[model samples]
Target: MTTITRRTVEYPADGLTMVGHLALPSGHDRRPAVLLGPEGTGISDLQRRRADALAELGYVAFAFDIHGGRWFSDPEEMLARCLPLLADPDRLREIGTAARDVVLAEDRTDPERIAAIGYGTGGAVALELGRAGVPLQAIGTINGLITGRPGEAAHIRCPVWAGVGSEDPIQPAAQRDAFAAEMQGAGVDWRLTIYGGAGHAFHHPLDELPDQVLLPGVGYHEKHAARAWRDVLGLLGECLPSSN
Candidate 1:
């Protein structure tokens, strides 16, 4: 097993002191970096574990925060903070860019090689970064199929891959269609995978978060979660292969 080192990083974004988790691989040489965005509820240990897993795979991984250092156990509170933020693309871009900068500042990160992968509202932030013309090697979103402003997606410079549950009410079929149309109209390289019978946030294991509210259409499927991780790995490998 590769030796992985982890630490907590503090930075500012949108008037909040954002706390992020950074994971470094075994070596000192610069490697491809991934800016990971957490779900709408906020940064959790789950996101940190994902970053560590990426480090074990030889990538400099930074799991960035969306809700400072807070985690919302109430659905209404989470929505109160995220709903407005989600409607504003510029704000999302600002948050995502802050996280990206954190990854870039790391000594082990390759300045020219980076990707953005996010979940839920965080996924939307990743897409916003792409639309803002940030040079990301790849963009991957899980359960965040959001459509951007008119003609903005044309600025995206790399392939985008999204995973969602087929029965996700939060990201229904119509929203998915609109997202697809935007990508297609912009001539951007994009792909979508709908996990059959799954629901929103299918990639997240709620069992690990016993206090979390069980929102409608939000459940976890172990099989699909594993598959989604594999698909994301494929996207990263295809777009930004990290050197061992």
Candidate 2:
């Protein structure tokens, strides 16, 4: 196993100091990198572990923070902040760009090889990065924002992979259809995977079971989460091959 170094990374976003975590693999090789986005609750231990896992896979991974340096355990508090942020495109752009710049400036990141994979609000940020015309190798989101802004999705120039639960209350059938239609019209190479019987934020298994039930239509399915991770890794392999 390669030694992975997890470090603290703080940057400015949302009028606050956002603290992210960077995981670098042991070696001098400038590997491909991934900008990981956390769920609305903010950067928790689960996200840090995710960055560590990505580093173990030999990719320079940085888990971006959502709500500054603080994490909200209360669902209402989280929603109060996340719901509003999700509605604003400019705010998402500012947050996503800060994290992208942080990873791009890292010594171990291959400038030409970068991808963004996020969950919920983080995933929307990833999509925003692509919509903002940033040339990303790939974009993967698990239960993230599926809808695109008017005439903005045309700027996305890379492949996008979005996974959602069929029973996800937040992402209804209408929204899914609209997102796919727009991506198709824009000619973006995008694929949407609907996991049967799953709900929102299904990729996170490390979260407590009690809290999972608290969030309506948000549950953890080990099988689906594993499958989603595999899909995300496959997308990265297809777009940003580690050999390159």
Candidate 3:
């Protein structure tokens, strides 16, 4: 069984104590570390579960909180807290760096074998970390928007894999195509996987409520989620290894 521990780390930004769940591999030392960025709603049970799953795969995973203790009952409230952070690109980069610091400080964590994975708004934060030249082994995003703007794809020193829904209204085919072009132009090892028939937030199984921003009729696709999970693990395995 994977061993998991919940802890709190203070971010210099706003001096806020963000609660995090750390998962460690059983009977392992100096394992790779992963900084997991939660969805816009903050760190939930699902995110914790993902961290545990990562630990089971032999990595020390830390899931950081963006909203502290605040969780929104409505989508608007979530957006209210997440949108401003997204709009200010600098803050987004700070959040990712703060989370990375927390994970790297652990004695058992391998600093050179670190990665960042995010969902939705958190995904954008991960992308910003890559854009800011954070020395991460890999970066992954789930159903996140990657605005194809100049200087966005450049400076990514690591491989990036973005999982998006082909039917996601927020991120259409054109946007994904543009992002791919930018990554290729930047000479970054990047890949985008489009899941057909899935809508936005395809990895969020609990997003069944009636939210205008996210379709209430749309729900998580289990098959696609499983596939994405495997793909993420493969990416991490390639980017973060004990030997490397």
- What clash pairs does model 3 have? none
lDDT of 2 by residue, 1-244 (tens): 7689989999998898999999998888899999999888888778888889889888999999989887776888988999889899889989999998999899999998999999988999999999999889999988885576888999998999998999999887887898889888989999999999899878776445344325788788889988998998899889977653
RMSD of each: 0.7, 1.7, 2.8
lDDT of 1: 0.94
- Candidate closest to the true structure, highest TM-score: 1
lDDT tens digits by residue: candidate 1, 33-120: 9999988999989999999999999999999998889999999999999999999999999999999999988988999999999999
Candidate 3: what lDDT? 0.78
Candidate 3 stretches with Cα past 4 Å from truth are 4-15, 207-218, 242-244
lDDT of each: 0.94, 0.87, 0.78
Tally clashes: model 3.
0
Reference-based TM-score of each model: 0.99, 0.95, 0.89
**Model 1 / residue 122 / CA error / Å:** 0.8
Q: Which tens-of-lDDT digit does each residue in 171-211 have in candidate 3?
A: 78887887788888999998888888888777777554333
lDDT of 2: 0.87
